[model samples]
Each structure stands twice: as C-alpha cells, then as structure tokens.
Target: MGRRKSHGSSKSKQHVTHQRQLSLAKRNEINALCEKLFVCEYAFHTALSINSAYVTQLWDNYVEISTILEKVKRLEEMKTESPKRSQGIGQFINWLKENGANLDGASVAEFPGYDLGLKAERNFQENELILRIPRGLIFSTHNAAPELIAILNDPLIQHMPQVALAIALLIERHKENSKWKPYLDILPTTYMTVLYMTAADMIELKGSPTLEAALKQCRNIARQYSYFNKVFQNNNNAVSAILRDVFTYERYW
Candidate 1:
C-alpha cells in the first residue's frame, strides 16, 4: 500500500502564505499613512508661514494612523524585556555615601521585566526621611546655566531653560573628570518616551488624545533638532564648540 499522504506540511505552507499576505498588506497600509504624513509635513515646511491649519491637518493624519494602528496586533518572544543593570550603580552609591548622601537603608535592585528600582531595605514611619541626596548630587539648572552662558542669548537657550540644562548635561557627560560620571554612568540609555515607541506601540495609544500630544511633541523636537543642528554647524562659541562635535539628535532626544 502507498504511504498515507500527510497534510501537515501543506497546512503549514498555507499558514505561512497567509501570514506573508497579511504582513504585506499591513506594510502597504502603514506606508500609505506615512506618505500622507510626508505630504502634510511638506506643506508646512514650504508654507510662507506656519498656521494652526497645517498642525491640524497633520494631527488629523496622526489620528487616522493611530486609529488604524490601534487594532489588535500581536507578537512577542520568550526573551524577557528589562532595563540593563548598570555596573556603575554600586560606584554611584559609594560616591553618594562618601559625599554625605544617606541611602543606608535603601538599595538599587533589579526586578524581572522592570527597570532598576530602589528597594527599601527597611520600612519607615510617616514623616521620617526615606533617603537623602545632597544638593551637590542634583544636576539642577542653577548648576547648568553658568557653563552655557556663552550661548545664553540664543533663543533656544534663553526661552528654554531645560534646553540649557540639557546642554549642560552633555558637557558634563563629555568631561574626563566629571564629578557626575558615576551618576551619568549609571543612567539608563533608554527612556519610556514616545520616540522609542514602535509603530505598533503607538497604535496601542490610538484612541487616546495622548497619541496626538506625543506626535506633536515629536514634531516640535524634530524642528528644534534641525534648528540646533544648523546653529551648531555655523556658530562657534564656548557651548557650540563643544556641542558641534558631540551633540546628536539621538542623544538630545
């Protein structure tokens, strides 16, 4: 008798073909939405002056894309997701202790699938201080402003104190003998920001107005980045000199 024909391989092939088709369709839909975005973006870029209309149009586009993307999508691997535990954390703690910052009862601990978190070693009563970080440990705008005084007149730095502080951070991080090296070294490279979101992830937020806010923020940041890039390229000053070589949109974001 002839060996019985197995249908499993044929079914598997059919499943593979279906998935390919679905993936191709999804890609085409996403591409079309992106193209729409480009067209709206170009209109704004080329306009004589930006107005509410351009932003509204783009926002509408984001809403459309977000709505489509918010649909049920699925996939993930067994590989667990978690922020990396920095080796510098220990050194940072030691440095803080040496500097009179008290964290004697709290320790940095890693939880599975979560970022490095400070775990309380001992419970405390109300009104009691849980921990204390010295003023020197704080990288405040007060500390950042003096270093960026050269470009303080620039509108970006003048209006945006946060931008000034950010630049200050860049300078400190770049320094060989930076006092904040331990803190900076322990800082996670990734953040829970919209810039890091996958298209699918953005889709998950589709129904919410927060999606629009996130998109607007992204657009504004891109514009600021372009402006800064131009300034850094042409302007030669104390801040620009250092940043022109090292400042990057990725780092800025």
Candidate 2:
C-alpha cells in the first residue's frame, strides 16, 4: 500500500512538471511571433509616415512596436475567451489605430478579429480619418483614467480633421495650469497621457482656489458656450477656430 501511494505522488509531480514545460514553451513561441509582427507593422506604418513632421521626427518606431509586442506577450497566457482580455485587446487596438494615424497620417489596417475602429466610426468611413495616439501615453504597464486619457487616447477625437483640434484642446487645457506644465511640455518625448492631463491641469489653473473649483469653472464655461463645446467635441473647423481665437486672446492679454 505504501508503494502504491508513493507511485501516485511521483506521477502527479511528473504531470505538473510537464504542464510547466508546455507553458514555458508556448511563451517562447509567442515571443518569437510577436517579434515578427512588430517588424512587419513598423515597416508598413513607416512607409506611410512620410512628409509629416510629427511622424518623421521620431525616425524609428521602436517604442510603438515594442508596446504592441508587450501587449501580445500578456495575451499569450490569457484565456482567449475572457471578457477582460477582450476588452484589454480592444483598448490596445484603439491605441494602435490612433498612434498609426498621428504618426503616419494614415489609418492602420484593421486587426484580424477585432473591429473597434469600425464600431467607433459614425459613418461609412467617408469623412472618417486616421486617429493617431500620442506616443508618450502608450503603455504596456497599466490602464489610465478615461477622462485623462481622452486628452490623448479618445477614439472620438484622434482622427484626421479632429486631430489638430484635439491637440488644441489639449494645449489649452495644459497651458491653464502651471503645476501640471512639467507634465504637459510640448516636447517630442511627451507621452499622450501627460499631454492630456497637463492640458486639464492648465484649464484648472484658471480657478486656483481648488482643483475641484477649477474643474467646475471649466465645465461651466464650456457648457455655457457652444463654441467651447464644439471645440471640446474636436471638430476640425472648431479646433482651427479655437486655435485662432486662442492666439487672438493671448495677444490681447
């Protein structure tokens, strides 16, 4: 009886070891696949990025490609059917689309099984344009807040016509707050999250009494003025007009 019990324990240990080995092997294969995908994506997007100062300025797309690679690695061990994984992949897809547009000035080709961009589109892709994400905000680390992310990652605001407007809104929002300026610097390395948060910081600066107070004032003012809401909505013309008005207002001040 003791011999039988020992035999059973040994078998169990062997099974566990086999499972671990399988998992490790799978992970290594995933890493290799991700490397191949990254190179392909970078090559495809870089070709389209010509002539744009923003995209050309970066030279190499290692940062963006690495982010996608990291995300794929996380997905390798995850259950493909899990809702959380699906949502995460969805968000990552959006991040890619936006970054592609911001840098390449062209919409990224769709993912095989995911269609977040198609769902986000209001029309049949006529007026719809590429939605580029600010490189600084793309992270394989953690999820960012929705509002703060909207400053850089909002699907509704990243497209062609709206891209410039989004940048203006972000800039205005950042310039208003001195405390957040360090995060909002208009430098090449600024992450999109920092830009958006800093922009919010700037707008909040107007009502210096408190963070809450500043938020309230900005919301109230934006709500009161249709133009403000339009600008916030991030229409191309609205953003252009807002940019003009901002300069005009600055000149007077």
Clash count for each candidate, listed in order shown: 0, 12
Q: How well is each residue in 61-167 modelled by candidate 2, as lDDT tens digits?
A: 33343344345435333221112222333334444454452433443234555532233433336765545455555421122222333334434344433333434
**Model 1 per-residue lDDT tens digits across residues 80-151:** 222234555676688889888988679887777886789999987888887898787788767543557777
Please tell me which predicted candidate would have the highest lDDT against the true structure.
1
Q: After best superposition, candidate 2 residue 172: deviation in angstroms?
A: 48
What shift in Å separates residue 78 of candidate 2 from its native position after superposition?
Answer: 11
What is the Å distance of residue 52 in model 1 from its true position?
14
Report RMSD for candidate 2.
26.1
- Alpha-carbon deviation at 199 in model 1, angstroms: 3.9
Which runs of model 2 end up more than 4 angstroms from their true locations? Answer: 1-25, 41-67, 75-253
Highest TM-score: give the candidate number: 1
